[model samples]
Target chain A: MKWSELFTSSVGKKWIMGLTGIFLVLFLIVHVGLNACIFAMDGGVMFNKAAHFMGSNAVPRILEIGLFAGILLHIVQGWSLELSNRAARKKGYAIPMGNKGSKWYSRSMGLLGTLLFLFLVMHIAHFWVPSRITGLDPVLIDGKEFHNLYGEMLQLFQGNLLVVILYVLGCFALAWHLLHGFQSAFRTLGLTNNRYLILVEGAGALFSILVPLVFALMPISMYMGWIK
Target chain B: MQHYNMNLTLKVWRQKNAADKGHFETYPVKNISSEMSFLEMIDVLNEQLIKEGKEPIAFDHDCREGICGMCSMYINGRPHGPWQHNTTCQLHMRAYQDGDTIVVEPWRANAFPVVKDLMVDRSAFDRIIQAGGYISVNTGNAVDANATPIEKDKADDAFAAAACIGCGACVAACKNSSAMLFVGAKVSHLALLPQGSPERKSRAVNMVAQMDKEGFGACTNTGACEAVCPKGISIENIARLNREYMMAGLTEDK
Candidate 1:
């Protein structure tokens, strides 16, 4: 096992997918938790404060670099694996068995992953670029300046039905992606024993449903004027 | 069991060699008994073809029973016909209707080039086995079966994994044509036994390397392989393979 073979081999690529996938899953928890502060009914005060801390903290800023790299590596390795898998089978069967062999989502991970990739780009453009790269308008709280990210969210979601819809759709893609990926990553990492597999799969299913649902709800709640 | 007759129209793939482009040739066989196995029906068709002075279809089969795993055919989009957990040789004509049109073809995968019609070279499997599919110990008088005690559950699991017949059905059934299930079966069978403990780490590393070198696709855990397996080889073997590979990567002395 040379250093080059680790990334070149099929099993190694799976290792990359699983490792990066778990890293992304952990990031989702922190992301959803930070975004969940909007439901506090404090007119974006708590949300903005949390967003400011996240954006300004030195530790998080450094971790953000690793996050971006993990995302790029995951996407590259995933597409390579998909392309090779496709190439392995030159021609398909005449009568295709669609869901008889495996689940629809399990077979369509590449498509789902691509959709999530596009959604991620759009999401970063809307929030990350405006907040971190170009800087956002400052809101003074306790005579301290903080980026009004919650204000930005309201402006983006309110009366902008298309953006809200896109956001919700992004969450939908994320949900399906996580549904297969969460358990799959663990399986790839070699947690295949029956007892632990059952537990991981159960936890994965719950996480897949809850995290995306909350992410989807944030935009819907904002658009419907449910949250200030 | 009730018996009946079927007049099947089989569109069997015909190819002279690996270099030749293959095509389907339709052959009608009337009054096939429901008791006849699928391969036996093919034999009947070939007999008819030979009587007519035409070239007979070439297929690979050793033992008519399922154990040899030498019989490889993709029948009607399935690796081993429509019957669940049955090999092509074990599939009976009773499963088909009176006028069923069966489309038979060879297992399609770049790693397995067709040597002839319905028979692709599966030496890639052999190469993988050669890579590390064995345990090394000095040969001597046969040790008693109970000389080294093993847990009943573990021994049973090892036997289950050992049941893989190197059939390549898993590769045929996979959407990606991946050979993980095959490799996993080999890895798990050896890794579970105390005799295989010495080379367990290197075995995982070497076999997987050989598997990749042979141009097989990565496993996506689609579970299709398990669905069509004649031996009912579990996907849990694949999980164990993954575990072994990871453990070997971490702990093996480089």
Candidate 2:
């Protein structure tokens, strides 16, 4: 089938949106859980070892590649869907206010997702690629020396207050993106019941908020000099 | 209630016939009351237009109670103005200012061609509904409502789906101009009920096929239709429709 035909199909787009969305949701949990390990440890050798483990592991390498693919697919599919919608309507009309009934986040997904994409680029350029490629020493944990990825990350976070602020702002954007996205994904995938919708939307909000809040805090703490 | 004297300009669309080129003609309506519905204000204006021996601006309206779904227009760029759940007929003159220039036009869509002035042929929706809304009921004296002991959940879902007034607002508000929500509502009503069960498989299959047959775009779950629907029909109904279609597709394979 032609590319346009696939993107414009109801069944096809739903699967694309759902499959990519579910993958990103899983990625969020794993990414946050690994970062949360930083909070559990005293900010020195122990955290460094954990970070080194996550950064250097074979499985983590595969997961990172998969996560990148997921983000790309999600973005492309979402943009295509948005474009078709715009093309369908010939004229514009006022969206009723307040009780117009859609959540504000629902209306602004495309905007927030665009901002998040920029943030993602900055995130990778600052941390993911440079740390993986450049040579770095490991902080020795209990006489064992490994790549000191955690210490490098801390140094990067502390050295730039702007990075800290941007990371927090990015987290806020992600939170808003996921607030509507999570339940909307369920609706797209055909998993809606009123009882389940209320539950899913509620749980989705908590999960979305919690992931970004926890991940963004690591940079925040380092910038504040809370951990040295 | 005191009737307040005021003058306001209306940019009304005028067309002599379907092939006739249309243009906006302004008219000044004076002495409007807050108690009058928006359409009543239009009536007052049309009454004056007729008195002057000019062609009266034509528009659609019925069941001023907001249920008939005949009153579809984009009032000041809104599908149904700024108020939620309001049809143009239900919108009160109090919602506007004395000096406001209210621009009115027919609901614009390829499927909905303008008939004349503000009235457009919404027969596209009727064609979609007729495509699959009928179920074979043996020639009938009315059956007892209690004959079918439908689960409360299913009954509620069916009632919600039945609430769709065949309003073209969903198509009007949709960015893709998708009729999925409208078709989904019909499919959902049947899929959720015992009376509809006998034809459940064919109903979804046929309704969706007809929805596509009409020049409607596909659903992308942008939720614009749900947001603007006066009835507040959730897009969840569309999701349910998807599930039913999937199951029907699988069942037909056997």
Candidate 3:
């Protein structure tokens, strides 16, 4: 096989999906952890400080490029896979097998991934744009200036019910996408041993739920004024 | 076991040929004994159709047991039937009750086009096998190759993979019509054996290329194929196949 077949072949495209998928999963951990700093209740001081560091740090700034590349490759390969898979089945079953064969979320990965992709656009536009591109409101903390991203989060969520609701829905989509993608990426890498698979499945299930729950709670907390 | 009977309404797909568009034709079959296998119940339906001067439903069934894998029927939206790890011939009527409506159809996939009623041409699977599903031998040493000591676990897994009957159930049950399970089984079955060491590099790559050439879809790791597999072929083989193909691609001898 030619080296190019690594991306062009079916299994090769899946390799792309799996490799990039696991990478993005790691990024989600960093992202949600950073966002979760809002519960510090120090009037957005901690979150702003952390956000400023992540935004300004040289290493992280460089890693951001790789993050975007991973996201783009995942989306492009996922879309191509969806199209080809659709073409493989020319006829439809009379009575569709709904969750009898596999989970509905597993079959609907393409749709869920698309949903997450759209949600990501909204999320990046609202926060990433201000903090990174357009600049956030400057707040002085501990004799240093930092971008008040938490202030932006509060401004967006507290008064606007729709934005909060949309954020919650976005997290919902992320949960479903992660539910299938977590174990799937491992399976795609041929992690077939039942012993290790059980652990990955358990950890994956917990991570998928907890990560999204934390992300959703940030908007809900700010909207409901749960945190100072 | 004291057995009863069922009068079922079967919605079977009927297509004249590969080019012919198919439709479901319902048939009421009475006095189907619960003791009879699913195929025998179908045999009753076919006999009735013959008496009524209608063309009997054409399906593929060789070994009346589960091993042949020739019996291909998508019963009630699942390949084979409702029973877990069972072929159509092994599916007994006892699972169904009287007045049940069972929908039967040919395997739906672009690669396995409908050849006739309830029978899709599965020659695509054959072509995939012909690609690299074998290992070349020196032809003088059957005993020497057989004596190679394989680890118990690897041997068991390979035997399990080798149990695949090539029924195309994996493809039929897959939403994508992906044959990864089928190809994976073939690849793992040979790759596990020391006798198959010679073609290890080429088997996975060549077979996968042929599988693509056959127009089968890519696997999405849904586990649907494993769920409906009559042989209970594990999706682990697919993971192994993925590993094998990648290793082969990266280390191919140019």
Better of 2 and 3 by lDDT: 3
TM-score of each: 0.97, 0.84, 0.97
lDDT per residue for candidate 3 within A31-125, as digits (tens), equals: 98988889888898878888888999999999999999999999988999999999999788997766777888999999999998998898899
Report the C-alpha lDDT of model 1 over B1-254, residue by residue, as the tens digit: 79999898999999999999888899999999999999999999999999999999999898989899999999988888888888899999999989999999998888899998888999999999999999876798757868999999999999999999999999988888899999999999889989888899899999999999888999888888998899999988988998898788777767
The digit string of per-residue lDDT tens for model 1 on A1-228 reads: 666765567777898999999999999999999999999999888898999888889999999999999999999999999999999988666666667677889889999999999998899999999998888988988898989999999999999999999999988888888888998888787876777888988999999999999999999998999997
**RMSD after Cα superposition, model 2:** 3.8
The per-model DockQ list reads 0.68, 0.24, 0.75
Q: Assess the local accuracy of residue B91 in candidate 3 as a C-alpha lDDT between 0 and 100.
A: 94
Q: Residue B246 CA error for candidate 1 (Å)?
A: 2.0
Off by over 4 Å in 2: A1-8, A55-59, A94-99, A131-135, B1-7, B13-25, B62-65, B82-84, B94-101, B108-115, B136-147, B209-228, B249-254
Q: RMSD of each candidate?
A: 1.5, 3.8, 1.4
* Poorest lDDT segment (10 consecutive residues) of candidate 1 chain A: A91-100
Distance from true position, residue B153, model 2, in Å?
Answer: 4.5
Per-residue C-alpha lDDT of model 2 across residues A117-195, encoded as one tens digit per residue: 9998998887677668866765666787777667777778987988888899999999989888888788767788777
Q: Candidates 2 and 3: which is better by TM-score?
A: 3
Estimate every model's Cα lDDT from 0 to 1: 0.90, 0.77, 0.89
Local error of candidate 1 at residue B100 (angstroms)? 1.8
